[model samples]
Target: MISLHWLILSPLIIGTTAKLMPIKAAKKIMVLFQTALLAAVTMIFVEVRQNGPLLENIGSWPDTIGITLRADLLATAMVFLSCFLFLAMVIFVHNKNYADHLFFFLFLGLESLIIGIFLSNDVFNIFVLIEAATLIITILIMYKQASVSVYDGMMYFLINVVAMSFFLMGLGMLYKKIGVLDFYALEAALSQVNNPASLILPYAFMITAISLKAALMPLFSWLPKAHGTPSAPSVVSAILSGLYVKTGIYVFLRLQTTFAPLIDTSELFVILGFITAVVGFMLALAQTDIKLLLAYSTVSQIGVIMIGISLNNPAAYWGGLYHLMNHAIFKSTLFLTAGMIISEYKTRKISEIHGVYSHMPAVGVATILSILGIIGAPLFNGSISKFLIATGASGSWIESGLILINLGTIIVFMKYGQLLFGHSDKKEAANSDILEKAVVLTLSMLCFLGGIFGSDLIAILFNISLTINPLSYGEKMLLFVGSILLGLLIYRSLFKKRNPLAFIRSFELGFNEICLSITLFFAFMVVYLKITL
Candidate 1:
């Protein structure tokens, strides 16, 4: 019970404390506070695992009128992951001079808001926390005060504000219809409601906002700019990719389940996931900037996870959840390593950087491991999750689509891997601090071990039982090898020359265009739901 309060308030308290302290002292206090918060969350996870969800109603109010905080397995797991990820990021940036008081305050505040998003059972509370998170993250993204990043931050802010406005209006509709905002109560009320169709407008409104937040197809224009901005801190990139985006996915999962009695738009999400995956990797393959390349890869991975969960198979759903954790590990490592590499080479272009294996062996090795995981190489975390997801796909078109997405992912990363070999004319001192190397290497090692013990890990974490057949290993290995070869050939023949898709790279959507896309998406979902019903 106290753990729930601590999870929500500790970070806020620490952030406020940091504001009152001197800069150097605040840095120390921030580190200590983060460490302590991680420890508290870990214990909470253990308790929740044993007791099965900790629930608290604020002010001892009844379920109908009170705000509820609930830490179920999913919520606790996310909180644990966010804590662990943020702690690693803090350590990674510890030796750097980026530890300004305001940075720590905003970062911690963001952490609190994210945890709040995960833990709150009230829909209105979730909306409030997400809005707060958006504000904090925007400040962090433009922390460097560069002109381009300032624009990026503003765009992110305004777009999200518009989305949240939709959410707020939807919440109003739900409250009017059901007279409650608690998820369980709302679900119960929705099940008892006579006209579920009447909820469709509110559902469409809320889901459209969530789709934008998750960076679904045609709504992801703001992601690359905010995530891959040159001026944004690497930890900021890591958090956005690793944790922030997942919050949207988390919300999507929860709300979809909560409103399941009214609508099940699982098929729509699956289709959108496929399109998003293809477009994401296609854009990733066309990128020259390494950070942008990684950012787009995140979009691709999110698409895959969305498909896995929406497939309505237990194995696929669990696999998607596992993939979520795996992605956080590998993607964070890649982003942080990319930051280190850019710092060393003084360039963001993949073509200009080479011989990383010779220059910084630790970063190089970490990058290689993360790449293997991202491309679903055998004995990496990605392979196990992908295999589980594919097992549930059962030779359907969804399976074929996933395979194609994998091939595209391979091509993009194959382009990215160019930095691992050959020589560069540029001479730069490649030195990374011990803490940074440790953090990257630690995450990389987790990626490897996660695959090696995938079955046990999944069972332990999610309590899902599954079997991996040794007989199928050879076939899986063969597929991976074939995909790599095909990716290499395609890259050499097409991408080796000038990128012909440069127009896609140069294209930018303005604010009005993005809002139009959001409107179109919502209208389409409503129409589809109406037709299907």
Candidate 2:
């Protein structure tokens, strides 16, 4: 009996009312609403898990005649994630100078759009939600206009508009051919087609849009700028890195399911996933800015998730989704801690900061725990996910490649780890709020517990029990330790010097060039479909 539309509509009304209220009252109301929303989402998640998907048509009409919304386990999980992250973020910014009424409004508006995207069953509805979210995000990235470059915000906005335009074109073709825009209907319609080749262009267009939003290779240039820009608040970065970016991957998975009977591009995505993972960490190695380092690391981790999802193995598929949630938790913790660190050190340069353990022990602990999770340390959330991914690639070269990627990840963190120690005398310890410390340290604990209970967590999330082979897990633990030692050696011998590949850190593609890449990528997908399908 839970109405799905209320989930999307309540936030907008709450946000607008909050904006008209006093700032202090606004923050209080926003947090309360977020907490309530989280509870509502949790109830829905449980119901969907217990029964099945909940579907509703607007105005009490039939599914084929009106806008439709459906929340299966996957969609509910994502919606649940969005609400949880927003709740954390609202609290994270509770005492900040920037936590104004307008800020609450913009933030809440984005949450509404994200939840709508997850629940909507209509492709056209999704397109509208994405386009609207894109605009809101543009405003947010430039919220503190004086601190960030106008160019960065404008660039992000333009790129998304152009990309989503392609999505619109694809939707047009889909509807023209089938006269239906619902994902379920389209899948059924496409299944009855005489030739799947006709769908190549539409698929390419939609995939291209999702790829850009997901920040896949060549399309990833926009991500580091948007997430790492100085003007973005830590909570905003957390939401973007932790929750917003996942929407793209969610859409990718959803659309793939829609097209499963007609085509399979798992092989292409697997190859691309590995490439993105490698290229991402390489770029991370070249960064001196701490925020940029973490931002690039996000790119690398996203690639790993994509790889797991793209694989044909069932365990790997679940592993990827599980990793997606793990990455959200740990990455958000790191960014929040980084924000406090920057505030304390008064610098963004990794070389200039030190002695975090001496200063803000809570933040340092959180940072290190997140670092461990990210590097796939033996008893961390990341290790569990990576182990499953590697297990799925058991006999292939990809397993070996994953090992190398793990090493690369450790190497990045080895440099990052230095931030946790040194003298704090030069700068006063970060006086983070009690609430902030509680939230961060709690998140860090979850990272550790997630590893210890990986199998149980997996079973709970997906309703499928996957047991880890003890012998394989032990072998991977040894590899993990070896990777740390090896990574340390590589960092000291090579990366300790002035970064020779700093150009990678500074690389930026122009709007025109990105447009060309879009064209090329579209053509590439078309050619790939022609040959494969």
Candidate 3:
């Protein structure tokens, strides 16, 4: 197996070296490096799956003092996913307008940072990695250097800096109290404490920042602006939507596990998840700009993932993790295709774009598969995960809520799906490069294959096998159909009219409002723990 240190360092090394080469040669070098990196990541993933976690403390120091790099199942899986997606993003940008040495350099640098975050055992190290990632992402968003792009990039940067301050404060509290920054060391230290109450404020502080990073509820205002920046390239949007946002949720899971003995905030996140999901889709429904619509949809999907994770059920939790992977595939496909569609049609408006199938059949097909995957259509990746989540929520009011969320997802996509049909006389040639098309279609195909082998994938990823009950699967299939019909009816009656959801489109949280919400959220978490514990 490859060393975890190299897994985190190789990308940065290649990126720096590529900068010194000729632009033409750099592109070729990038291809070789990406191929080698992905192969190394795959081997590490296979080794971890076959054996167990690979743990090392760097600098040859004692475990408690050294920087520990842990390649557990979760960390390795995330590394593999990040590597795969980064490779795809690189390929998607090949021969495209934004395929420059500097872009690839920043892109690979971000990959290294993300890998570091995944493998880090020290909470402080995670904080540092996230800070570096935020800066790189800011530069990426502002890559166009246009007036609006700069403003969006700065807005994203300012908001994240505020959030990271909360994280740093929490880390300081934990270290001061436990005298340990490493997760294993801290967990051991925390167990000796008599009162779990001491960690409440720290949990509140840290989770508040992580929730913001996950784009949860009131903190989600930055997502649309960053992801839908008019000047941002499709590859950038794909990585932001498909990969970067997930790091927040991944960190969220890590912190929750670390504090498992002290706190059980699943209920709070479940409530927040539902609200975020509902509100997110409502905003998506109101949007006319196609990229903004997809960005808002991402907010809604994150909410669904949170619900799956926090439901306090094994089925739901695994489903959430599985859905997280599925989202990376299908959503990346959508953003990549959306970029192509916008380029070909010369507009981002949902109403203005038409004849997608006639204009570009391959892209149109990919979009259809991706939409199917996202909406949880039967025999797709989303259905399997949502089914597992529904199985966990069965016979409860929460089940109805899950159904409603599914319906909302369908309705929003129904609005977005208008791009696939209508008339066009233009010929289909010059439809993006073949390589870009291949990347999008490959992700689209994964959306299909992932479902067909959902249970097997879970077994491989989680080291646990689950068999989907045939009878229950049939029932879920019915619910899926029913939700589709209901979503379509609602879309026509309410959405197609003078557009009932149109006004909510303009609703956006300002910087001040987002900051206030963060404080309130933290207060709520602390107070809730104070009373309950």
Candidate 4:
């Protein structure tokens, strides 16, 4: 008999087999399987809500011997969010034709790895799951068969697989020392030791490896390439950016909590988070391609989430998790809108794709709402979480720094909004597929309504009633207005004359490679300097 835990792998197994069938059948089968997966996720989420954490040991083996599959509040929340997006993507793709069946294989493989990442108890298993995800997602990016996507996918695969190898090695060392592969066991072992060398080296290795996979700054060069170039389904990109990236951070969070004694101070993570937040926005501000801009924005927002997690306070943790969900919905919807616009207008360049509103009102309105949500505008889902993040960082320099990041976010969105509204000479669009429109509109509505009731949702999810009232509403509204004003000023002063395409042309190939190499060199040098000095 199949257990409830194995339900998570149902779509993966079915989709993988279906991909071997005829292309037409493969897509239909995959869609059905995805719906089933969604149902499974919903049931599991209901279970988690009613009963704290749900656990099942595969094969009915003892806890120490068999693999344990556990769904905690965070894990269930991520799964629920990811599965929701995946179903939306399935609907969006119903009308879009693909030549081959390999896409379903890649999708299923990623889904399996996602579930595995959240369910597995062993540290080594997590590494394996991540490696599987990396390999499969790379294939998905290359499924486009375009030279750009293929080359970018290869680079992303190489980088992430290498990072996972490092993670595995670190886990091996920890297992060797502790005689167990369990996170709880290894953490307990680390706490009993006093040697900084033994603890810090492994801890640093684990965090660094996971951070690279999460596309946190300095190691995030591959993100814009892969995400921007792939014929990424909005649902796929949503989960990849939303839930998969968070898996790395989840590991780091677990390590921080369980192995706090062995971990380095939060100082390093906080500093890196700050760097990631600032640098990502700066780079994002310099992009002309809509997808690439959103990709960089994702990198920047993940940085903000990291900073919140690094604070190690309950407020920060809750805020980080909240923002993670908010970002998944809004950014994915934004990307979906971008895809729809590109499909209709036959261009990825934001400058070339003007007057979209003239032909694609639903997509345009959805895009605008998604942008508003992400910008943390008043009554949007994003504002609530952003406020929490800022509130958590209050009275610290981090707060001030986050203010700058928020301002940058607003500035970028302001530019995006201008692009949405500017230079209209009515041009007819090629395809206005009803299914695609429906999916996009659904996601966009979620972004709007999610913000309107963010507080009630938070209470339901975390079992804590946050003190939110009219006063809090007014305060957040002021922050939003201030950000908008600053963004307008920045755009008027700095971006008024520059040709954005020129910047993109310069960075196409060499910039990312150089940045990645330099970061790897610096990581090595940090070690060398530590030894020599």
| Residue 67 local lDDT, model 1 | 81
Q: Give the per-residue lDDT digits (tens) of candidate 1, residues 170-227.
A: 9999899888999999888888877778988899899999988898897888899889
Top lDDT prediction, candidate number: 3
lDDT of 4 by residue, 1-533 (tens): 23446756776777767856877777777677778777777777777888888778788987646777778877777777767777777667776676246666677667777877877777877887888788888777777677877787787787776666667766777766677776656667677877656654555567668777777767787778767775655555566665677787777777777667754457667777889988888788888878888888899998888888788666766777788888888888888888777776667777776766656888888888888888888878888887787777878999888888889888887767665676655555447789878887888887778778887888777666665557866977887788788788878888756745345547553445734653573466347435532
Q: Output the lDDT of residue 14, model 4.
A: 76
Query: Which residue pairs in candidate 3 have backbone atoms (N, alpha carbon, C) closer than 3 angstroms, thus clashing?
Result: none
lDDT of 2 by residue, 82-165 (tens): 888888888888899987888888899999999999999999999999999998988888888854646778888998898999
Which order, best to worst by TM-score?
3, 2, 1, 4
Backbone collision count in every prediction?
A: 0, 0, 0, 2
* Residue-level lDDT for 489 in candidate 4: 80
* Worst 10 contiguous positions by lDDT, candidate 3: 423-432
Give candidates' CA RMSD values in order.
1.4, 1.3, 1.2, 3.0
Model 1 TM-score, 2 decimals: 0.97
Q: What is the TM-score of each candidate against the true structure?
A: 0.97, 0.98, 0.98, 0.92
Q: How does residue 75 of candidate 2 score in lDDT?
A: 90
Report how far residue 18 has shifted in candidate 3, in Å.
0.5
For all candidates in order, the CA lDDT equals 0.89, 0.88, 0.89, 0.74
Residue 4, candidate 1: Cα error in Å is 0.4
lDDT of 1 at 265: 86
Q: How far off is residue 401 in model 3, in Å?
A: 0.7
The total of clashing pairs for model 4 equals 2
Superposed model 1: Cα runs more than 4 Å off: 426-428
